[model samples]
Target: MNNVALITGASRGIGHHLARHFYDLGYTLILIARHAPALEAFAATRDPARITTLAVDLSNTATAEPLLRQVLSDHARIDVLVNAAGIFRPGSTQTPVDDFSTLLATNVTAIHLLCQLCTPWLLKSAQGRIFNLASISGVQPFGSIASYAASKHALVGYSRSIARELGAQGIKVTTLCPDVVNTDMAEGSGLAADEMLSTEDICRAVDFVMSLSPAAIVEQLTIGRQPRPRQPR
Candidate 1:
């Protein structure tokens, strides 16, 4: 692909690994996140020439259009988009109504707005690809992380619907749903990450999505734990 890729939530975790993998394959990178220091560290290794970093909170839904416009205008073109940035706030029976709005805005609204603004630019490039980082919970009624799972489930449906609409335009949309991973988010969950998937594993899936022929698309791929889980003693 001769065009550049824009990656959100690229400061670390799955986002960081994806940036590395894509850069190795010669894809120009545009990394976006809110943390300046982490962004800088990523740039140091990825190089400022091939990979450009943007410190922005994509959760600001109202500014998505203008912000994307500026970035695209400066970069000249965007061939691929990795919607890796996400907010996962687990809610329980006591989940507050006020906080639910914030979770929905960050998890669902941001991705929706970015995809809308990214379409025109993506169509311009021959290798236009949209990768949405969804979760296996999207396919099941995952009750533990209530709001997080709900948002992802909705996102999966939204992404699939958009895929049908955009397929003819030569833009491929892929939703990646991986079971628990060894990321910072999982660290605080009190769940044992033994043999859990790594960020690199998911990034590999992203790379595979890019490598597929336009005639075929991996619309939904469910990745999960290794060896499966054993029953309690």
Candidate 2:
């Protein structure tokens, strides 16, 4: 049987790319995203039998949780889980309370709930792997994106703690903390495409993580771009 991979944020960005990668590798996919058109379009190009697309807004866990449960009911096991659905709110300490709440809801709470819900099914797989896409902000505080940073920090902390707990049960949990990637999110943050890491760089990190043996687990993989050289005056 083909291993099952449940990937959130499947409409675009890193998640979308990874979904394509896994699909090409013969893994059954359960793709979740907020936009149905993109998901449907992607699904249309592939074998419909192997793909399941769910358009869900992760910021609303109450609505998304049950929908996820219903979808997982038909799948026998989940071999790979990529929690890549996230939202960014650019602001400092003076950021609106609502922005902070939304960031935490989508970036932290929703992933926590997903890890909880998928643990059982993951345990059933021979090579269960959970990949949580965090950000450089998770480790280093960035200016003007305080709420986003805080939420990622929370996610990083939670994922690390669970890595210890889940490792004992033979599940490998990897937290990917990549610097700005060339995605819509990064573009919206005023980062030029040249200044950010490519989606392929992030995907390479995942490739490395997935290649490791069962005995070896990658707790965290951080990928950053090299600084451009200073031009002489």
Candidate 3:
């Protein structure tokens, strides 16, 4: 049987590209996102038998368990799980409490819940891989995106802790920290698109991680662009 991969945020950005990459590698796919129509549309472009789409807001704790249970019921096993659904907002110390709460809910809490719910299915697979989409901000402080950075940092810590706990079970958990990608989220951060990494670049990293042998594991993979030459003064 083909390996099965369930990717959150599969409707767009890095997750969308990863979906295509995995499909090209012949894996059965379960695409999840908040937008049902968009997920359905993307899945329609692929072989219907190999693709499944679920419209879910991962941040909704109450719905996440039921949704994951349904996925396990429909598919025999899930070899890979990608937690790529995230949100970012420009903020400073003075940012509203609600803004910070929203970021934590979507970026950190949702990832935690999904990992908890999916661990069992992942353990059942012979070669299970869990990829959490973190950001460089998770490792470094970014004043402009304070809340986002904090949430990502939390995700990074959680990922590493779980990796250690699950390693014995043959489940490889990796936290992917990319500096800046040319996605809607990056564009919203007011960064120059030309200087950011492409979605394909991120997907390539995913491909590499997924290709590793069962005995090998990458706990953290950080990808960044080269520094541009300084302009003559």
| Clash count list over all predictions | 0, 0, 0
* Candidate 3 collision pairs: none
| lDDT for residue 215 in candidate 2, whole number 0-100 | 72
Best by lDDT: 2
Clashing residue pairs for model 1: none
Which regions in candidate 3 have their CA more than 4 angstroms from the true location? 188-190
Task: Please give the distance, in angstroms, between residue 130's alpha carbon in candidate 1 and its true position after superposition.
Answer: 0.3
- Lowest-scoring 10 consecutive residues by lDDT in candidate 2? 184-193
Ranking by TM-score: 2, 3, 1
lDDT of 3 by residue, 185-225 (tens): 77665567778899988888887887777677899999987
Model 3 TM-score on a 0 to 1 scale: 0.95
Summing lDDT over every window of 10 consecutive residues in candidate 1, give the lowest-scoring window: 60-69
Q: What is the TM-score of each candidate against the true structure?
A: 0.92, 0.97, 0.95
Number of residue pairs clashing in candidate 1, backbone atoms closer than 3 angstroms, sequence gap of 3 or more or interchain: 0
- At residue 179, candidate 3 shows an lDDT of 94
Global lDDT scores for all candidate models: 0.81, 0.92, 0.88
lDDT tens per residue, model 1, 1-233? 34588888888888878887778878888888879799898788655778777787777866566766787777766888988887777775567877777777777888898798889889888778899988888887767677777888888999898888888888888888888778886777666666678887897787777777667888888897777568999
